[model samples]
Target chain A: DQQVKQNSPSLSVQEGRISILNCDYTNSMFDYFLWYKKYPAEGPTFLISISSIKDKNEDGRFTVFLNKSAKHLSLHIVPSQPGDSAVYFCAASDFINTGTASKLTFGTGTRLQVTL
Target chain B: DAGITQSPRHKVTETGTPVTLRCHQTENHRYMYWYRQDPGHGLRLLPYSYGVKDTDKGEVSDGYSVSRSKTEDFLLTLESATSSQTSVYFCAISDDRELLGDEQFFGPGTRLTVL
Candidate 1:
């Protein structure tokens, strides 16, 4: 069974508009959530993160919103630019459950395209 | 940015052959991990090491083995390759001294194809 899921496989948005990506998790033990962006032939780079204690976290034009009650989270990018186009992955960790290490569970991923 | 490199970035081998991939890191992080990325599976953990000489299996450890003899290196081996095992493999490192947010730095990747 997939613990984390990204329902949408792809998303397209016009440049200068807002882009939204959603993710859902089945395990309630997850306490920390993170987002990573990947370009072709490259490793993923950290974009933003949010703790379960808080409902939202923002950095520049990227904002991450968490709804613990719904076990869902969304990433919002305002004024999306063509450079923002890439694959986005959502990951969650449960430090308490994985006693020794904070092992992560990643969602499939969503491909984002910012059209000109 | 994490000073990590994966060897044999691209390889092709026939079934039943043995293959090993290397991961070297300069960060000297205490934790190293092996993951495989498939089209529909996202990224699945194969094995991980918390320290030199200490390794453990992950969600998808079958048909694979791992070794961590030194602090800066980790190895993943496939005893007998199979077509089903063809995928992009990634290596990641983490430092326990940092926060417990589970942030991991990844290497480029190694694409292996089993014919």
Candidate 2:
């Protein structure tokens, strides 16, 4: 069973345009969410994240909006750059500190293309 | 760009062969994880180690095992390779604050092709 889902396989947008990537989850226990950017032949790097308590979080040019009521979240990149062309993965975790098995559940991923 | 390294970045092996992938870290983090990335299955945790010799099975632990003798090294071994096991393997590391909302750093990944 896929606990997390990224419906869009790929997306393309022009430079300086806003890019929105969507993701969904079925589990309600997930308390923290994260997005990672991966490049070819390289490991995924941390992008941004949001907590269940908050509905939105923003970084320099990236923003993550979480809708706990709908079990959905979206990543928005303002003025998308060519360097943003890569695969973005959405991950959810229960975020516990009990020392039990704590792991992040990831979505399939969405490939974003920033065209000039 | 965390201090994580995965050895044998690319390998081709046959069925029934035993293969071991190594992950080395320099950050001295307490948490280490092994994950496989496939087409449909985004990334599934194989097994993880919290400390030296302390390990636990992840969601998908069949046909695979892991060992962490030191804080810097974590090894994933396939007892008997299968065509189904062919995928890109990633090793991630995080500190004790992982559960407190810290992100994990991933390795470059190892592509294993089992025929």
Return the top candidate by DockQ: 2
Q: Tens digits of per-residue lDDT for model 1 on A24-110?
A: 999999888999998888888889999889999999999999999999999999989999999999999875233356788999999
| lDDT of the candidates, in the order given | 0.91, 0.92
What does DockQ give for each predicted structure? 0.59, 0.63
For model 1, state the Cα shift of residue A13 in Å.
0.5
lDDT of 2 by residue, B1-115 (tens): 6888899999999999999999999998888999999987788989888889988888899999999998999999999999999999999988765353558899999999999
Residue pairs with backbone overlap in model 2:
none
Clashing pairs in 1: none
Which candidate's TM-score is highest? Answer: 1
RMSD of each: 1.4, 1.6
Determine which window of 10 residues in candidate 2 chain B has minimal summed lDDT: B94-103
Instruction: Report the error of model 2 at residue B41, Å.
Output: 1.4
In model 1, how large is the Cα lDDT of residue B1?
Answer: 83
Q: Where is the poorest 10-residue window by lDDT in model 2 chain A?
A: A94-103
TM-score of model 1 vs. true structure = 0.97
